[model samples]
Target: MKKGFKYVFMTLLVVALMLGSFLLGNKMAITTGDKVILNKSDFNIYSKTNQMKAVIDKYFLFDVDERKLEDGVYKGLFKGLNDPYSEYLTKEEFDSFKQSTSGEYKGIGIFITVTEDNLIQVVSPIKDSPAFKAGIKPDDIIYSVNGKVYPGDKLNEATAIMKGKDGDEVKLVIKRKNSTGAYDSIDMDLKVEKIKLLTVESKVIDDLGYLHISQFGEHTYKEFTENYEELKSQNVKGIIIDLRNNPGGLKDSCVKIADYLLPEGPIVKTVDKNKKEEVDMSDAKEENIPMVVLINGGSASASEILSGAIKDYKKATIVGENSYGKGIVQTIAPAKSFGIDDNGAIKLTVQEYFTPKDNKIHEIGVKPDIEVKLPDDIINFGPDFIDTDTQLQKAIEILK
Candidate 1:
């Protein structure tokens, strides 16, 4: 891969790694996005670390593992950014991250994000996957993994524990909201399996097409196009796009799908720290049918891109609550370019994205045209839950 690699619109969760040589700390010159350059001599701050290392080497009670210490320095480097989305990936984590974009992996099959308070929140479980079948729902909190508590900062470590050989059981302690607005702890022993990515799940609800997009993976565009075409062939007159609890994924996948539904215009725009701007546009061709997009707190990044575009152009009526409001973008740059490659890469926050109308999505989410919250009675998104789905019923009411 080249220096500036893929522009990903998703959060690839991970942290912690074994240490290696600190070739990067001493003589290497590193460049920052904001035109800051750090060379060896300018890095006298390392003297403090060295002083601590000397003290630990002399008086520490137990043997110090240089491997883990080195890894800590690497992680600490990125953690200095204070941006939760930006992280340094180890070789193993990087490999797994690549596999996740490909839409398949050996894990319990759930998308997750770490909160500001260092809690791990489940965005959604992949439909039909182990976690999905186990009834793990959105907004669920993961307290511990395999009896070990991993703070939000150690998300990568927790995920590492979750993924493994098929049929291997891993225990997860979850905190779920219950009746009377209380939280309940639940223990689950989930089996690791090879989860095949099926991002788009579609079926006809009378004359309307209901398509729930879990995430925008690499194959998402192709799958979305094929599924929409199938719905068209079946004479479905309207559409309901479900993005609830959908953790966003690839930018390109979302762009292509946006192009299919929208008329010629800018889908989304991004500007980096250098004030450099790039706008993704759609063609004149468009789908003319009535459309309703469903979004909630979990609908983020590229999902906001599509829904924002649809809202900007009045292409679709938005339903449900406000979105997750993650307007910033991240990229996986080749670590080799920085002379720090051990088959690993760095995911850095490169740019802040805007909706087509130039509205910022960073901390403020997109508002729905008609707001309808999910009813308290509706729990799982099972077949029987649709009638009680107030947001969905509102969408149906709009189309009718």
Candidate 2:
């Protein structure tokens, strides 16, 4: 789900697009972490591939594009790993991925994520956007785009399919689950248009400051800092950081905000395949303000980084259910770097990141110091519905 701003986990959670070209067959150089490793593989995969290709070239009756054939093999490299996060992207999909971090783009404004069952599900529709006006709601499964079914693993393709000329219409088939657990299929046609991302929203309730980070984007740190100044101007006593339903975005943005909040200490650490560790530390003087971080199943990757760091330093009280627990990092490189063309790209799982306390948060999420659970039906609430947000009320109570 990514290709921009260092390490991105959510792939923008948007309809933004990034385009590039792809080429193939140079198997020597591979990008790992920040380095390109050049060495012959211990396995004779090239030989096996050539053998299979020879048969296809000699015996297959139907004509096949040799480039596409090789591209399929290249894609199989990542797919064979069987890791859900790592993937191969065509030029169109890669372009869509790069556009995700820009904070604005053209599309049918909708935020989507992968369900636990690996189905593409909508998180929410952007206010006043085509999807929103069409009555699309949170938790609705995106069954198909343009009449073609796209599974969770192929979400990048689905997102790419949503992009087109301004005013272009995109057909959507959604599967919405009803109260009785029965799913009702609905079809809607929405037009693609330019939309800006609002990553952070803030509020002041008497002495308490409330900051809701929908997701980390390229400009989120700037937005957060601006809001923090406003909260300070209001003479806020404490701050509540809400990371519920935040899938996560740019790692650099997350690190910047964490650095802004914490003191001269390690914010997070990353371990590469060789077990080499790098620590990201903050240089700012510590702020002694009281803090409570709120997280739920949707809090992941970069979200986990910020919450875990705050908790590690004992700088905040963590509340709500366990986070989404994505501790690994993924990096994408243009396929041409490995000697491929047609704007092809490869996103591979490069490293695992740990909290400041050296705690692992991959499958095991960051646990709350004080755990609270919201009813399933009420998990998604707007700012206007503060009374129904028990986790937020609990945070406010702690701050008070």
Candidate 3:
């Protein structure tokens, strides 16, 4: 009877162990049953994605490239965020972008953008580049490339057509407004060249330091500080920061430059979705020199950050039209970092940054203390082209 009791006890223990394992598996939704139960919220969250995969696998006619399909799905997912600044970069595009950040590339070396009027406008031609040599001016509307007419919104497509192996020639048909107020077509034959991007251009104009930052890049702060130090050594009375047609770049670079220029204080603040605030502060010990910043509609992102900080701190007089007003901060990460095998990356808008004075300039851009509009005749003239820069004149006047 004792042996029988022992056998019954051992059998009950085995049954209990099995019950525990089953319960644990069920809790984790890991049971290999035909239909594993899931929490209602979790089911709702994943059901649409599962359904989309099922529909695509079943109804798609072509033998789809699984990789391309996956990329499309990811791109679509980000597009659903309804944020223009958020985007998924394909492997090739991401690699190209990485190359650009290094401040070197094989291209025509002109920054182009789609305007609000559905025109492909040249933001600016890199100084001493093939485009600049070929006389591709800012605000020039690109009508066609090599006889191919691309829609204005297809800025990337147009850019690709313009970029080719070094020494290759691309023909651009551009329309510029003539003195009579009518657009005149001009043909430009430009040869692609290896472009080494330079972000900072400096000169001393009548004892005032004139610094033109084309765009903030990875090496911008180093270039800026070197020029700034040289200007200070020259005993400059004041400074002018020209940020016209600057599409902006790395925020760290901008903040560092601001720190070097401004007195010790907060530079900018960023707030995430959870309302967690992160402030970037300046540690400069010297008093800020009298200065003026030049801005225009093309000034954006990092440009806004630097100019806004200066404006908020009363460090400089801001001159020109309203800026582009891109206040959202983007964080880029590789797909592998997020547990995906795709050799691509996502640039997601993770936070919104505010000026030092807690001013948020997202859709509404930072206003200038002194507003100066570019004249129609001189709009195409480069930012530092100097001859017809009324905005620069205004800045110089302010500094003086």
Candidate 4:
């Protein structure tokens, strides 16, 4: 009887050990197998991270959810990443990210900034967006959506709350302070629609033709160049290019427009994180046509590049307020891991751009030759801060 009992006990012990080994192997594979490699040396310490992760899992308050851990690991990995343009987006958030890339979404079409005071203030609304349609003006601070305060949240979250299925309604509670008085808690409901930006707005204001290039969209250069050709064919003597509230897009598109406008040598130069500088060359095309470019505080990135280049080359008259001072350039690189993280999209600020004169415009924005602020008559109507557009008028006058 004693011998039989020993055999059964030994067999049970052996089975238990085998099961434990299998569980441990499975755990290790789930947690540590899917690793990402970053180009930098700092990310090389991931092997040692396995021991640390095991400790964290043991001491963690709640059950260690592997999925959440995977996300945290990926996000933590990017903690050492220096670029602000590069970030990890959650699955749902990534799906809702508002990039001008695919170019189709809806909401009260306004770009807003989260202020230090926990206020969501409008930077500017796209021309004829739902925000413009619902009378949500610029400088209006959004306090809540559907009565839920969302301060300190991601801008994408606030934007998501405001966007929905077409014909759906979104309520926004806003706060605005100006010369009139303190108007707080103003509420507005805007209907969501399929929003497509019409980047180019052209018209003939007397002898000169006016073209407003809002952004460098996918087909911006095609539209811009074709319009210029039409203007030249129409015998328009002067041209005014309005880049007010224009945030730049594709670098090539900006260069294309610059090439058309200037008898170009160097359009812009880029210095990467490695401090390597590359000069972008341009072919002269729109050299002799008298031109004026209008800019404002909202003009940034590629917009600044184009305006700065034109001004440096004496190719066009720069009009209006100083441009928004973003001089960094970004390139999107693939994500390393295909499993936990979707291929990583890296937007490294590889270089700081310089104009033809080798002028650097990092924090200090472009200064227009003619400085003008918007008039109050336009400001009082809604939340919009109307820049007098006297500069645009001046350009038109010069062209005429």
Q: Best-fitting candidate, measured by lDDT?
A: 1
Worst 10 residues of 3 by lDDT: 23-32
C-alpha positional error of residue 190 in candidate 4 after TM-score superposition, expressed in Å: 1.9
Ranking by TM-score: 1, 3, 2, 4
lDDT of each: 0.82, 0.79, 0.79, 0.69
lDDT of 2 at 71: 60
The clash tally of candidate 2 reads 17
Could you tell me how far off, in angstroms, the CA of residue 224 lies in candidate 4 after the best superposition?
0.7
Clashing residue pairs for model 3: none
Pick by TM-score: which candidate is best?
A: 1
- Clash counts per candidate, in order, are 3, 17, 0, 8
**RMSD per model, one decimal:** 8.3, 10.0, 10.1, 9.6
lDDT of 4 by residue, 111-167 (tens): 665455545777556777778766665567888887788773345568777776788
User: What is the per-residue lDDT of model 2 for residues 30-125, given as tens digits with 9 covering 90 to 100?
Assistant: 334455432235224654565576687789999887656656776778767877678788787677777867777888977786655779987656
| Candidate 1 worst ten-residue window by lDDT | 7-16
**Candidate 2 regions with alpha-carbon error over 4 angstroms:** 1-44, 51-67, 109-118, 121-141, 165-191, 337-342
Write the residue-wise lDDT of candidate 3 on 112-133 in tens digits.
7556566788766777888877
Error of 4 at 252 (Å): 1.7
